[model samples]
Target: MGVIGLLMRPSELMALVKLKKQIGVWKRRSAAQEKDADWEFCFDMLNKVSRSFAIVIEQLGDELRNAICVFYLVLRGLDTVEDDMAIDNATKARLLLSFHDMIEEEGWDLHYGYKDEKVLLEEFDRVVRAYRSLKPQYRATIKDITRRMAEGMQKFTEMEVTKIADYDLYCHYVAGLVGIGLSQLFSGSGLEDQGIAQDEALSNHMGLFLQKTNIIRDFLEDHEDYNEETDTRRVFWPKQIWGKYTDKLENFTFGKNQEQAVACLNHMVTDALRHLPYSIEYLSNISDEQNFLFCAIPQVMAAHTLALCYANPDVFKGKIRKNLGECRNTHPVKIRKGLSAKLMLETTDMQATLSILEDAIDSLADKISPTDPSARETIEKVQLCRDLIVQGRRSSSPSSKVASTWRQETSKATSYVAEQCTVPLLVLLFGITAAVDVPQALGSAWWQSEAVPAKLGPVHVWLTSLALAFYSLTLLLLTRGAALSWCKALSAAQVAMTAAEVVFSPVVGLSVVVQALPKLLLAAMLPSCAKQRHSRQLFAKQQAAMGNRRVLRPRPIKADKSY
Candidate 1:
């Protein structure tokens, strides 16, 4: 789910049109035949979103649309099974297993004339037929994803209690895996190289981000459903974490536990943010038509939604949302801007954009602030860190070379600092041994003196020395890292600072440094003994110099290459 994905072919659209047309016809007929206004409304509501997807697909050439439509229907069928209460667990299990069997048995029947036969099995069959008709290359993608979905579904069991991990698996099965499939479609659509590794990362992460969003959004609904007197229950939130925070899971419903709910929402949002970069990268990889609606729309929607969620605290109010109008107006403009700015992805402006978007999402759950107090401190810190990183890159003799090297060296330095910090203190205890002293009679021959026992002396010294050395290294490493981190933080703060010229001018930088004097004084007042342990080592100077010089060097320039 972490990979970038390819595009679907142009020809695939034909199949999608056919399947959608059938679903449309089936909907009309069923609405008339069953006379169930509520049922029709439900499908219509779902289709409102699905139709947007269809429009995007239709715009793609037929070949891609056809394949996507089939996959879409198959997914819809699974969703129907999961949602439909009329069917027994036995039937649901059978249907889930049948999906896997259908992949191998091209003409296999998944629904087998069950309740809601027309909506589930009929639509599923149409997609299957369309899939079989696709060229072998497209067929292969469908088959692979279908198999993954089936594998994920078949693993579900009625006899066991559901775990958080299982819910994650379920998300992977239904949505994250689809993200992977869609990525492949995007890659294969003949837009660009659509490198497998990058696409795979995008595919997986996008799906995960979306799935996590759904979980966060659905917390209220899930909580309500879980409490119903039914055989099934929702346990999407991990019991360990939820139990630690609150006694009753029901408290998580929107109104009563808004703050707690938001905290849980934050956890999922944080998890999604971890994957946001990949989602961006994945969208960036897509070329032409597929990029617009498929890549751009969802990416922007999710981002805006995240921003809204962050800015507002009412997400627990049944169904908190940033309506479509907001998405419609904001996304196109942002995407237009994004496409142009994509080349300088690692630049400050780019980072600022991401930070802004993240803040926007977070702002939904909290109050929007021009100078939000909660994140102001963190923002300032990160700004300084990045600025130092940028400054270290710009300070070389030629300046241009420094500028060029800034990207490469700073990254290496930052990574080195982080990497060195992560090494365990135990690693420095490699060559330890132990011995002890004992008293002996003076008359005894020197050689026959009572042997000193081989106690844990050497070992203790080695361990203690190592611990001290590691502690020392950690302090030094932290100082340099903190300095670099501070540098970036200052750089970030400069943007948010009230007066840019004033902040960057000699006076403000000096003032900021002065304000930081307490921390600086504390750091300096700590004993110089921290760096003394390795003083006699052969390469101690070299190591210290190397570590020091890295901070003074340039950063890695991630060249913007064609997707």
Candidate 2:
């Protein structure tokens, strides 16, 4: 990964952890109140959802988890600022500034919102205390998350503009940075490069994906409670894309623009899905278990969002959550044996990007450390470390696009070898009864002549021909299998890309190329030549052009399930 790419991703992970912890503390604090049962339940569900993230941190050691936790705990203060409508703007500004001051001074005042301030405050205090108990590094990360939150809030309150751009920025302030943080953490794990640097673009897309999904899902409530007259409504749907569907989207308030919103929603999902495969490489590289939590939760959440988009409209009416019960019921158990791992290693493309994230989390089970900090400053340092790592990596190599191309090419080559193999085999079978048994004829070709060679008898020649035919037939069967595998794999990739219309424009006439034509050709071709490496290469070039290389981004694109 490039310097900023690594740094950007790490920031994403850190931001995500902070968000989750803040939510966790809020949920815990709110659950104590008798009147807020429903709220508590929602928070609890969210917390349950958060546990899936535990997989990321599972291997990173306690310092990383504490670092993340502390950051979120402190940032929860700022979230309280935005979430609590009762708080006046002036006080919110003061509190946010105070947080900024705490970062500079190395200490913070925790008494401002202690009593009747809300569950978040109490939860924040607890996390802060827990953070203070950790090592300095962890404490620093906590402080950093808080500081960033403070800075973000400062920007939010001081802003004179409220454009759709502002909402996008706000989402970034709130969530996009998390995407950046995670990318760093992922790089730290040191996986074989799957274009991690170029992943910055993908990372940004991922952040937008998650945030946009949130915005779409929360459109009704935000409009009801948080809408500002000065600001335009719902920046989640960009003007360019919305122009095509606005007429159809008019009345779709609570799941109103269900169809169109899903189209837009999928733009982000597919973006996430595109990068999601790298999580496997990341997990394989990491030695710590705690890191898994950071990886798994977001993946599960992303998957849940995708499911919601594809599901009923009720998902938009309220939070569509994947709770512990639901998650457990559906969760896949990783096949941990060497044989299974070996098999998995051979089929990286087949593994769902979602599984990559979960697997990263799953891999963290054996590596938890207890000394980690869950504070803001430490999280910030972690962010800085990530930034440093990305920078360092970038110093070694400059072009993300070129690197991505190499990785894609490598993937294609490996897939080709795994999918295709040429084996010679017989195409015909017949019994020949020699009229002149054991005759020695010199005129015609020995096998066809029903004659024995001068040195060997006719019987020996017949036996040799039979053996050659058997070998050829065996080779033919193997070749047929290999050719069939290559054809299927190639088509599958195309089908998947086409399905992801959210990420790429669909080729108007490529369906036949990826579908009917290849299969037809495979069936009609001579078995011996069908699996020829040259033929496979020629076909693969076309598949890569159609499936991997970018074409123009589709206008008003919608995701399909072509796969």
Candidate 3:
């Protein structure tokens, strides 16, 4: 129905043609992978649940293709139970808590209420059959994530999303876990670098970004989703946010509070935008083309969805906004068929994707109101996205063939040098902060060597104490796997203090200046810590995910893997 309305526009019509061709290719690719009745049913269920995900899932290698298909279905089945209002809270909670085990039980089935989901759940044994056929590592990854997610869902089922932190944790459980599970599957398949799986924090952002967009865009639908018998509405919009806009969540849907509502909506959109840079970094690290597209297409689509939803009134309207004239509904909040198709075509082209992302960032920035409480935050996040886009544009440029070749070669060698130096450099910073056998800068030099005992001045001692305090706080919050902003601020302050010591310490000689240079370069290098969201959460988050247990030390892969 939406596609029929979109056909009037020439560009959309062209996009539709291209989209059809792509589907044809995917279908041809899928035919070879389909085995028997059980697999066919699973694939059929995949299509019904998500055409976008199923198409990409089918294009994967034979072994991986089955594992991912089963993984997605298991997660989707869990989600269906969570979303189905027909189930009583007790029943839902019980089901969610045990969903991980249910996948292995061939007799497990339930009537989840949604038409498509009813079929998926009722015939879930087929999915279980397919899942058992997967590699043991793949099955382990799927089971571990499903267990964690189900526990999370059951927990959240009993609470309201009252705070932004609550909202993030909820999103982490439902969506972020999907990202982590996929990464585990990817690495377990040996199709991607182990670092990709090890970087659970990065994976979490990718899912959060997409999940938050869905939460924001479906505002009207989720808002209106009331169950009279249970006397509950499945509202995921955090009260900490919506409470400031209007006294009631449904007030956003009314005309009287439209002004305040749009501000609230823009605030949510901006919060989602904060995750974009991390998503880009995760996608940039994908080495396989199919894997890249599998992640990239949906990510690009989410960015466009945010572009369409930014301060748009239709989000509060109770319908899918359709594209009719110039594929016009893109602005009205529904990501249209043609535009998604066009975005898929552009996913492989970094510059094209950046242009789309830049447009989305512009859409978000242009709507920031000075009067809104979150206006400054929205502006800052928007600018961050733009900055990253600018960097992407520069990197994707191909005009200088000679320079590009030289850069690739130099980057290879420089990358190796960085690999060897990185650990020792980190150790030096830790050693200095720890007051381990190391020289303290006297604010005028690395140390006054003339002093026989080298007892430090109060200023030097204080600076060391301050840096140590910052390190301790940063590490502590990192251990808790919370307070991302705190992590960034502390890390940034630590870097700045190091820089101050390097610059303020008098360059007593060329030897002194030379000694300070690496510290200065290390300071410069650590900006990525500030630039990337959840930088400290990489190990800490994985630690927390593994039941607050310690993480295994990662074996280093090639430092300069391709985007």
Question: Best by lDDT, which number?
Answer: 3
> How many residue pairs clash in all the candidates, one count each?
96, 84, 0
How do the candidates rank by TM-score, highest first? Answer: 3, 1, 2
lDDT of 2: 0.40
lDDT of 1 at 451: 32
Candidate 2 vs 3: which has more lDDT: 3
Give lDDT tens digits, candidate 1, residues 304-346. Answer: 5554455244555554233311111111112122222221122
Against the reference, the lDDT scores of all candidates come to: 0.46, 0.40, 0.71
TM-score of 1: 0.49
Range of the 10 consecutive residues with the lowest summed lDDT in candidate 2: 365-374
Q: Tell me the spans in candidate 2 whose CA falls farther than 4 Å from its real position.
A: 1-60, 100-117, 157-168, 179-209, 226-244, 247-250, 255-289, 310-563
For candidate 3, report its TM-score. 0.68
What's the lDDT of the predicted structure labeled candidate 3? 0.71
Q: Which model, 2 or 3, shows the larger TM-score?
A: 3
Candidate 1 error regions (>4 Å)? 1-49, 103-120, 156-168, 197-199, 226-230, 311-313, 319-563
Can you write out model 2's per-residue Cα lDDT over 1-563, one digit (the tens) per residue?
33433232344445445555654663444334342332333233223324433333332443344345444445555565655444566877777767634534422344333223344453443444554555564455445545665667667665632344655566556665565445544443343143443354444444655665565555445434432433323234444344444543335545677765544444433333333333333333333333444444454454344434432344335532232211111212222223222222222221232233333322221111122221122223223323332333333334643554465567556545433422211222112212221232223344442222344444445443543453344445444444433433333332333233222222235543543343233222333243444345534544453354333321221222111
Q: In model 1, what lDDT does residue 554 have?
A: 30
